[model samples]
Each structure stands twice: as structure tokens, then as C-alpha cells.
Target chain A: MKNIWTIAKREYDNYFASPLAYVIAAGLLFLLGGIFLIILQGSIQQAIFGGGTPVDIGFINQWFYYLLLWTVPALTMRLISDENRTGTLELLLTAPVRDFELVIGKWLGSFLYILSVIGVSFIFAIVANYLAEPGIDQVKMMSSYLGLILIAGALLALGTGISALFNNQIAAFFVTLALFIVLWLLIGIPASFFPSNPAIGDVFRYLQIGNHYESTFNAGVLYLSDVIYFLSLIAIGLFTGVTAVDSRRWR
Target chain B: MIRVTDLTKDYGPRRALHSLSFEARQGEIIGFLGPNGAGKTTTMRILTGYMPPTSGEAIVAGYNVMEESIEVRKRVGYLPETVPLYNEMVVQDFLKFMAELRHIPNPEESVADALNMVGMTERAKGYIGNLSKGMRQRIGLAQALIHRPEVLILDEPSIGLDPGQVVELRKIIREIGRERTVLLSTHILSEAQQICDRVIIINKGKIVVEDTPENLQARLVGGERVVLRVRGDAAELSAKIEQVKGVQRLKSNPDGSLEFEYLPGHDVRPEVAKIITNGGYEMLEMKTLSLSLEDIFLELTKEQVVTPKKKRRL
Candidate 1:
């Protein structure tokens, strides 16, 4: 356990040393800034031109979640694949550390990096709270943040698992991005194909990450099922990654 | 200390190691000398518990490598063929990280001691990317030594190093061997000759020879021989040389020289010289014959020429 933390710390430091971490943070912040500005502009236009009600203007809070579907690949791409490309996998394997420690350390490191990106996204949240007229729904806002964390954890876990299976970082990035997209919109493909089939739609909705996020967590109606789905996704993804790292012994 | 008995490894039917066995007693630097793909790395990997052998057993520091791999890993330090380092880390930081990974108590002191051993205390804060290749290799050695392991396994530690660095690295390895058993692999025969207490020559994944460098060098040429260049008739010199005591065989060369193969524990050159002087032959040159390790290495690993299959005419 001590070795695992040490590995995680080293991995985190490696990320800090690289510009990619800063780039990912800056990109997420910039995307949220744009979203924050649009929400502020809409609020201003409603106050000046129409004196409209702001109760339904909940679009800005969810834009960042949508953006997360794309930006996460950059953060998790190099987790294990870079180790493979750099031949450091050999060094890590030969060390006294076990397979689980290495996999967990890498996953934890990427998770922390994702947290930093989310931390940057908080800047917009802070600004919107101060500036919005009717004010952001703190409950909905809290749950959305929780939802984002769950989604980020799930995406990072899946990304780390896929990263372990590839030697090339680019391939890891694309495969993870595609998988996240599939999970995020999993129900769409099945629903469009079997529009009238209620059972298939229910099954696809259950499998779709968006169903748990957009309907319950994103809408601030946090459900036990939503928590279980994301947690299970995280657990299953990490297990797959651990298995991949363990298989390296035979390879 | 490390011991292996009939270790065999196969990768999808292609055997990487073939029943290889060797031992390194405490404080002995046993050099693993072999050409590329001779399973030197594979054997070291197995001993270090990087992977288990398909058959047989390996014991390192009194722990079975297959059963007590964690303990074996804790006691043995390994440097792989390529010194894989996190290039983003500073030297001191990397060593400290490795010490912590090895679960060494008092990481600061171990890191300091390892850096001091490699003479890198001054450059501890320097980035690994900025360091020279030789320096990085030393840093790799430091990480291996950080935990004060009982046995050190270095695979081609001096490869790609300059001649001066190779000598310096060998000296470091020799110093390391004084306290811990060192099993290092290298294709450089001279390095082994100069550094190892005993050398194991592996060829085609088999132990071709295992002995001290001096003995291997001596065994090839057998007993002793001298190359004597003389200006004389071949028959007269041959007749007198055959009469010399302890002289085993004589072969006359086209350059009017004689190669004398004498019995072991004897030097009949003086008697033969006297015989030549009495025969009124002027001695142009006389030199003792000693085969180098290179000669023996080539002799052991020399491949047999295989005839090509004939083309069938349709």
C-alpha cells in the first residue's frame, strides 16, 4: 500500500512535469468559461429585453458535462500506454511492486489529474453563482458536480483499462474517446433502431450513461440506481485494468 | 546468493532458455557472457522473479523464486537491458521513489547512500533527461543498489558506455561485488575477463563454457606454445626440437618459423633455444603463445556451415 502511494505520487509528479496536464486543465477551464459567458449573456438578454423568467435557464450547468465526453481522453491517454511506449513497463514490472499497485497507482494519478481539470472548471461555477439573477440551484448544482465526478471516474477507469491494452498512446486515446461516446449515448443507437420496442428501450436506457446522468444526477434528482451504475462502471473498469496488468507477467 | 537448476522457458513453443543452470556464491561477481539472444536476460529475469521459468527452480537469497517471489524481489536488485527511467524525475527523486517502491526503511538515507555509491550526490537534483547516457546508467545502478539488496542482477550495465565509463562501471560493479553477490550479463569478453571472478559463456541458449577467464584463455591453447621465427633448414631444426625435453609437438611454418607445443608445467624454450644455437640457426624472433578470450569465445560459438539444399529441376 505504501509502494502503491509512492508509485502514484511519482506518476502524479510525471504529469505535473509535463505540459499536457496544464493544457488539459486550461482547455477545460476555457470551455467552461465559454459556457459561463453564454449563460451570463442569456441571463442579461432576458433581463434587458424580455424580463423573462430564469427558472428554466438550466442549460449552462450541463454544458461542461457534455464537454467532458471529449476532453477526458487527453487526460487519461498516457496513463499506461506511455509506460509501454517508453519501456518503463519493464522497469515497473521488475520492481518489487505488484500488478495491482501499478494499475491502481496509474488510475489514481489520472483520477487526480481529472480532479484538477474539474477544479479549473469550478472557476466558472464560482462566477455564475455570483452573477446569475435567480441564482444557480445549489442542490441541482451540487448533484451535477457529483455527476461529473462519477462520469469522470467512470471515463478515467475505462480509459486506463483501454490504455493498458495498447502500446501506442494515440490508439489508446481514440479508443477511449470512442468508448466514452458510446457509453454516453449508448441508448441512442438502440432506440433509433427499435423505436417502438419498450423492453429494448428500457434496456438501452439502463445501459446508457446519459440516462443515469441527464435524467437523474444532472437534473439534481440523485437516485441510488444512478450511483450504483457509475460505481459499478468504475469498479468493472478498474478490474479489467488490473487483469490487463496482471497478464503482462505471462507476456 | 543465487542458484538455478534446469531452468527452461518457452514463448509459444520457441524456447528462450534451455535447461540453463548456474550459481553465484555470496560476494562473487559471476559474469554471464553470451552473444545476443543467448537467454542471458531471460535467466536474469527468472532469477529476479520478473517471470517464472516454465520448468525447474531458482533460489535467490535462500528464497524460492517461484514460491517466495515477493521475498526474492525484496532481496534482489535488478537492472534491465535498457535502463528504463522516468525521464521527468530528478536523480535524487527517482532513487527515493525506487527506495520507497522497494519498501526500504529510511528512504532518505538509502537514497543518499545509493547516490553516494554511484558518486551522483552532486547531481541528485538534476533532471534525468539532461544527464548523459553513462550518468543515467549510473543512476539506474543507484536505484538497484538503493535497497541494499543481497544480490544484484545487472544486464549489460556497460553497454553503450564509453571506454572510460566502461572501466569506471566495471570498477563500481567490482566494488559492489565485494559486499553482495553480483550476476551481470555482457557480451564484452574483455570486461568479463577483467571484472568477473568466474565467467559463464552462453551460446545458442546453452552453457558452452564456465570457468575463470584465465583458465578459459589457457584451456583453448592447451599447455604452452611458442612461435619461433628462425633462419634455418626445416629438417635440422625439427630434428633438434624433437630431442628437447618436454617438447610435445612441432610444426614448421611457411615463414621459416616453428610453433612449439610443449607439455604442461614446463617451458622447454631455453633447451630449444640452445638446440637452435648449436645448430647454427639465427633466431629471428621468439614469442610465447597465449590465446585471448576472444579466441575461445569464437571457438565456442562458431557456427557450423550448413550446405544449401539443391534446386530440383522440373
Candidate 2:
């Protein structure tokens, strides 16, 4: 555990020492802030005209979760790949740290950084409380934030795992981005397309992470099964990372 | 502190280490002398627990490298051929990070001590990327020593350094080897002779010879050579020199010089000098040549190459 923390602290400091973390955070905040302004204007206009329900800025939480599919890979792509490129992987391998500890530490470092970026987006929620009627739904907002954190954890783990398999940061980035995009697009496949084999379509839907996020966590409902689903994904991703790193010795 | 038995490593069909074996006791400096692609780095990596051998047993600091890797790692300090350092990190912070990884009790003091040991205390705050190659190599050495392990494995530790740095680095290594076992590899034979208490010369993944530097020199050099240059026709001088009692072989050079080889204890220079002066040719130079470490290395490896070829012909 101490070894894991030592690695995690160094990795976290590394993220901030470079411009990658700041660039991604600033870019996401700028784009999300624009969306928040549009939602705020729509809510004000609706309140004056009394045409429809008030727009809660909390609705933008889905965008935050979805954007992570793209940004998480960018955050985690250099975790192990850069180490391999710089030959530091050998140093780390020869250190008195376990493979699992290294992988978990790297993922945890990115998770903390992404969490902070998500935390900064809370300004949008505070703005909604003052600018919109039927402002932010506190319970629902909390659940949405929880969902975003869980999704970020899962994506970062998967990205770290993919990063371990590659020596080039660009290769790790594109592969992880492609995998995450495919997982996200799985939600669009309709069960009706598989009339004879509905179970296959059902399995696909069950595998799509958004299905659980949208149905349970996004609606302010807490379910152990949904939490377990994300945790299982995290476990699988970390296991893959550990295996890839350990294979270096054999090679 | 280090022991290996029948270590073998194969990358696909190419064998890297072919059942090679050696040992190093505590407080001794062992130099692994080999040419390129001779598996020196492979052996060091295996000893440091960075990788496992295909078929072998290695016990480092009383722990099996394959089974108790973490234990081995805790007791070993390894400096690879290419120093692995984080470019963006400050030297002190990088050392501190390594100290933390080693789980040192006081990272601050350890980092300072390491920096001082490598004479990089003033550059501790400088970023590693901005440092010169020599400075970076020193930093690499400092990080390896931060943990103060029982054994140190350095691979070509003086590859790119200037002459001054090489001397200083060798001095530091010799000091470190006083209480800890140090195993270093180099292609430079003189380096092995200067620093190694015992040198193991390997070629083609096999041990060619292993002995003290002086012993290897005394064993391989069976005869003495002398070069005599005179202001006269070399063909005439060669014929006279060959007639000397102890002269085994003589060859004339293009530069009006004759080289004479004789038994180890024989002094043929006086006889050759008499012959040269009797011909009324002014003797310009006469000097005996001593065999260098280079000749010993070539003789040993050359013999190995010949034996393999002869076996293949059969």
C-alpha cells in the first residue's frame, strides 16, 4: 500500500508539471461552460414565456460524463507508454513494487486529476441555483456527480491498461479512444435488430455502460448492481494492466 | 552476494546466454568484460530482477531472483547501459522519488547524501533534461545508490564520459566497492584491468577466461617482442637478427625496422644490436614491447573462434 501511494504521488505530480492536464481541463471547461450558458438562457426565456419546464444546469452532467470517453484516454495515454519510451519502465520494473501496485497507482493518479477537473464544473451547478427556477435538484445532482466519478475511474483504468500494451503514446491514445468510443456507441444498437437472437442484443445493451448510468445513477437512484458493474470493469481493466506489465519479464 | 548457475536465455532461436555461470562475493569488485552482443546487459538485468532467465538459478543477496524478486530488488542497485531518468524532474526530486520507492527511512538525507556522493549537490535543483550527458550519468549513479543496496550492477558506467569524469567515476566506484559488492561490465579492457579485482572476459555468450588482470596477462603472454630500427637496408638486418641464438622469429617492416620475437626470459636485444652495428648501420631505435590488455582479450577470443570453426568442419 505504501509503495502504491509513492508511485501515485509521483505520477500525480507528473501530470501537473506538464501542460497536458491543464490543456485538457481548460478545453473541457471552456466548451462545457458554453453549453451551460446556452442552458441558462433557455431556462430564462422559458421562465418568462412560461412555455415549458425550467432547464436545470445539472442536465449538463451527462455531457461531462460523455466527454470523459474522449478526455480520459488523453489523460491516461502516457501513464505507462511514456515510461516505456523513456526506458523508465525498466527502472520501475526493477523497483520493489508489485505490477498491480504500479498500475493502480497510475490509474489512481489520473483519476484524481480528472476528479478535480470534474469538481471545477460544479460552478455550473451553483450558477443554476441563482439563475434558473426549480434550480439544481440537489439529490439528483449528487448522484450525477457520483456517476461521473465512477465512469472516470472505469475509463482511466481501461486507458492505463491499453497504455501498458503500447510503447508509443499516440498508439495508446488512439487505441484507447477507439475502444471507449465503441463502448459508448453500443447504446445506439437496437434490440429489434435481433429478432431471432434478442439475447445477443440484450447482452450488448447490458454491456453498454451508459445503459446503467442513464437508468440508475443519472436519475438519482443508487443501485448496488450498478455500482458493482462499474467496480467489475475497474477490476478487469487493472488486471489487464498488471498482466501486460508482468509479461515484459518473459519477453 | 551474487550467484548464478547454468543461466540460459534465448530470444526465439538466438541464444543470448548459453548456460553461463559466475559468482561475486561480498565487498569485491567483479568486472564483466565482453564485446557487444555478448550478453553482459542480459546477465545484469537478470541479476537485478528486471527479467528472468529462461533456464537457470540465480541467488542474489540470499534470495532467489525468480521467486523472491522484491527481496532481490530491495538488495540490488542497477545502472543500465542507458541511464533511465525523468527529463522533467529536478535531480533532487528524482532521487527522492527513487528513495521513496526503495522505502528509505529518511528520503531527504538519503537524497542529499547521494547527490554529495556523486558530486552533484549543487545541481540537485536543476532539471535532468537540461543536464549534460556526463551529469545525467552521474545522476543515474546517484539514484542507484540512494537505496544503499547490498550489491551494485553497473553496465558500461563510463561509456560516454570525458576522460576526467571517467577517472572520477572510477574512483567513486572503487570507494563504493569497499563495503558493497559491485559488478560492472565494459568493452574497454583497460577499464577492467584498472578497476576490477577479478575480470571475467566473455565472448559469444560464453566465458572465455576468468582471472585477475595480472594473471591473465602473465598467462597469455608467452614470449617477448623487440623492435629494432636502423638506418640501413632492413633485409640485410633481418637475416643477421634471425641468426641470434634466442630469436624465434623475425620480420622486417617497410620502415627499415626489424621485429624480433624470443622466449620470455631470453634477452636477444644485445645480440641483435651487435649484428646491426657490425653491419656499420647506425642503430636508430631498440625497444622491448609489452603485451597490453587488448592483445590478451584478442588472443583469448580468437582462440575460442578458431575452436568452434574447427569443430564445425568435422
Using all chains and alpha carbons, the TM-scores for the candidates as numbered come to: 0.88, 0.92
lDDT of each: 0.81, 0.86
Candidate 2 at residue B52, lDDT?
A: 92
| Native contact fraction (fnat) of model 2 | 0.75
Compose the digit string of candidate 1's lDDT tens values, residues B1-314: 99889989998879988898888899999999877788899899888888888998899999998888888888988888888888888888888888888877899999999888888899999999999988889998998888888999999999888898888888889998998999999988888999999999997778988999888877765766678887868777888788878887687766667777776688888888888898898988888766568657776777721332322211
Cα lDDT tens digits, model 2, B25-54, are 998999998778889999999999988999
Q: List the candidate 1 regions with Cα displacement exceeding 4 Å.
A: A45-61, B218-221, B228-263, B266-284, B304-314
Structure candidate 1, residue pairs in collision: none
* Model 2 residue pairs with clashes: none
